[model samples]
Target: MPGIRKSLLQLVFSGTSMRRWNDKMRPMELMEVDKQAHKMIMAWMLYMLNGSDLDRKDFIDLGDKIVLGGMYDYLYRLVITDIKPPVFYQIKANPAHYQQLTQWVLEQLKPRLQSLGDPFWKGMREYYADGASRDDLASRILDAAHLLASQWEFHLIKDLNPKDEEMDEIEANFIQGIEGFQDLIGVRELMQGNKASLGRFAQLCGQLRFQQRWSQTPRIPETAVLGHMFIVACYGYFFTLMVGGCKARRVNNFFAGLFHDVPELLTRDIISPVKSSVKRIGDLIKEYEFKELDSKIFRTLEQGGYFELSRRLKYFLGVDVGSEFASTICLEGDTREVEWDQLQTIYNNDDCDPKDGFMLKICDDLAAFIEAYTATRNGITNDQLQQALWKIRKKYQQVSLTETMHIGGLLADFD
Candidate 1:
């Protein structure tokens, strides 16, 4: 069985420091992690758009591919560390040099990644060892999402740095690369000329990058809601794997983690104290979130004939289930709440479409704890940050998410 380790979790968080577009002037520093968050979210949208053409088995395979591809790309970026795109592609143009560099990257990753078990390590090694290419539909979707996300970042600084000579070439490359994936579902709609409703939804989701978490607190390398969502999703996926979750459970948990905070994009990040300060303030917030979600997001998608997307988003948000943290399973065309034990023993299979909501909540809390811990470690010793670190550690000190994964011991590593 797989087990979560400090090295694995720390490896995922390391992307927080890997800056992007560092060669250009910009409004704000764009990090590699944020771009990854945007890319995966867009990839999920593309995956859903193409669902009609895929079967259940295909769904499982494609979802795993998108996530693994994202992880591999992140690791590669960490190894390359801000190499200019042109120069990097030139390295790729030389097959021998590229293979040599890939070997080095694999060597760098093995110590940090091998703990996840042989299956994951073998798959990752074979992917690069065999030459990573965009041959499948999932690869096309992920590559298109990556291009579109990078283009979105470029648009942020385009007007400010108008005199940069390479800007036009960069923009043209983005267009050309994205165009190559237009044959895939959802790619054409996101292109420059299209006015798809899904495009608008993507833009709305992208705006979360500007909404910083812990909005009032000062911290080194502040994180945004967008990147935080992605981190939690990653934790959820890994934890599911560790706990022996089925394919559908793994995918559902990942996506549920990814969209858990979608309503925050509309309502903005409300700290827990404010939400619970008044008796029914939390309830009122939920009511408002649903209303805004229906009006601004769901209605538009449904009107545009993307009913399935809207339905899935609603399911992810736990609209009918009352809370996103409630464990759930689909049975006989209806979603029903189930106890975690029942889910593990009975419905832990593809046909049931199980989602480990409680586990997702643990992942969410773990992500938040890590965020606080990282900021504190970076020399930001403010009271808010310190208190956050203390609170989460105290809460999970005796908690264990699985038989082999002890939360208290994991938290102790930061001490």
Candidate 2:
């Protein structure tokens, strides 16, 4: 009986050792697989980051390619190795590989952790989580990752966030305000005309345009137009209060700055030379624009049951009516040729006053020049600054008497 007990104890100890060995070996194998997968995924990410300058047209297809080629391998290796054996065996036995892959990807990406710094590392961790459905996981992961990546490309790469604490705070707060406004009113839905026109007016202040020209110009990134508008609106509100304007006027000034360049949505920034050379071109362009606005674009909105959207835009932007403030805000003709008297008349309009125009103009110029200074700090030439300054100074001459005095004093201080 004693011999039998000793033999049983020895058998149990040997079994435990073998089990530990097998467990350790499995992880070693998994690690090897993961290393290969990691290398492959890293290469793929690098390729995607640099291989193509994808525009709006290429985004979907490129996303598909990344999922199939890179994400699939990384996700599959993780699930097969890291997940509990029972689940892994079940998934491996499933015939629908794509479905399984999708499910696993979703499980990994559901939390959508943003890259506080390294997107690649965060993405890898996301890929390794083995619990969620693939489609949902992949969607969330890609969305968050892409958002951070886009911001990095557009803003950070240009060193827009300067090292200076004050400037960083100013820029950060301004961006936060813009993003907050978007969240407050649901910018995506508004821009698509799924919401009211006033909402769209708000969203318009958030849309970023002219990415290519952004790096070259001394102006704020076209992407930050909405953001800059919000800042201007804030300043306009404060300035109005300082000057003892009515609350209604202050609110109007904010809206004016917010929607000041909505026409650019259609016309883009028609450069000065383009507007100057063609006779009757400005009128023709406006006529074409009015037709387009009334045609497919707005009609599409109406058909889609966004009548409130169209109505609100028409009311706030004064699209159908003659509004001196709106007209002044419009980029109709060559600003180079615009007369001081013409500008004064626009400022003195009944619905909006010169004070609003002056505030808007100052804010606009200040934004432009600050952007120029930022660009110069980022290694852009003084030539770019000079060009921006020249364009701004041209309008300075056309400002109202009050604006002229205020801006003159401001410029003197800067000098």
Candidate 3:
């Protein structure tokens, strides 16, 4: 059984410090992690749109590939941080040079990744060991997502970089690459939307990159709400796998993590202290979030013939159930909330389309803990960071995610 470890968690979060578009002038520092978060969101959207066209067998494993692919790209970027994209592509064209560089990356990753077990490690090796690109549906969708997300970021800074000599060339390349994926079902739908519903939804998610977490506190590498959601989603999936969740349960949990904070995009990230400062204030905030989400997002999609997308979002966000953190399963064509213990004993089957709300909450807390812990370790010590670390540790001291996984014990490794 796989388990979450400090090193692996830290390894994924390392992208927080990896800067993007460093050579160009920008309004805010665009971090690699935020870009990656946005990319995976788009990739998942594309996957949803075109997933049925592929083999049924692909459904079980496609989500894993998308998640792992994003991580693989992130790990590669961390090692080759100084290499420009154009220069890196040129190097990639040379098989010998790319292979050598890949081997070095494997060597670097081995120590941090060994804890994930041989199967996962071997898969990563096989993916990049030869320095070749995958051409399957999942790979194509991921590539398309990467291109579009990068183009989105480019648009943000395009006007600001008017004086940069490479700006025009870069913009042209982005447009060409994005248009190249027009054959994809999701990409084509996004591009051809009469109301631009899909495009608008994607843009809304990208904007989360501007909303920083812990807005009032300073940290070594400040993280955005967008990247934080991706981290939680990845952790939710990994933890689900660790405990032997079925494929549907795993997918449900991952998406639950990914969009858990979508309401925040409308309401903004209100700190916990403020939310709970007044009784029922949190409830009021949640009520407003649901209203805005229905009007601004869900209705737009439904009107644009994206009824399935809107329905899935509602299920993931628990619109009918009242809380995303409530364990639920579809029984006899009706969604029903189940207690954690009852869910484990009864509805933990693929056909039920079960989602582990308790598990997602744990993943969210873990992500937040790591954020606070990392900031303190990076020498940005202060009351807010220190207090956050302490409280999170205390909260999880006795919580066990699985028989082999104790949240507190895993966190203690940081000390």
Candidate closest to the true structure, highest TM-score: 1
What lDDT would each prediction earn against the true structure?
0.84, 0.40, 0.84
User: Which clashing pairs does model 2 show?
Assistant: 102-134, 103-133, 103-134, 106-134, 106-137, 107-132, 197-309, 205-226, 208-223
Native-referenced Cα lDDT, model 2: 0.40
Candidate 3 lDDT (Cα, whole model)? 0.84
Once model 1 is optimally superposed onto the true structure by TM-score, how far is the C-alpha of residue 244 displaced, in angstroms? 0.4
RMSD of each: 1.5, 24.4, 2.1
TM-score of 2: 0.41
Extract clashing residue pairs from model 3.
Answer: none
Q: What's the TM for model 3?
A: 0.94
What tens-digit string does per-residue lDDT give for candidate 1 at 392-412? 888888887667888888888
Per-prediction tally of clashes: 0, 9, 0
Candidate 3 versus truth, CA RMSD in Å, comes to: 2.1
Please say which candidate is ahead in TM-score: 1 or 3.
1
How high a TM-score does candidate 1 get?
A: 0.96
TM-score-best of 2 and 3: 3
TM-score of each model, paired residue for residue = 0.96, 0.41, 0.94
* lDDT tens digits by residue: candidate 2, 231-283: 44434443443444433344445555545555655666554446668997876
Task: Flag regions of model 3 displaced more than 4 Å.
Answer: 53-57, 189-195, 331-333, 342-346
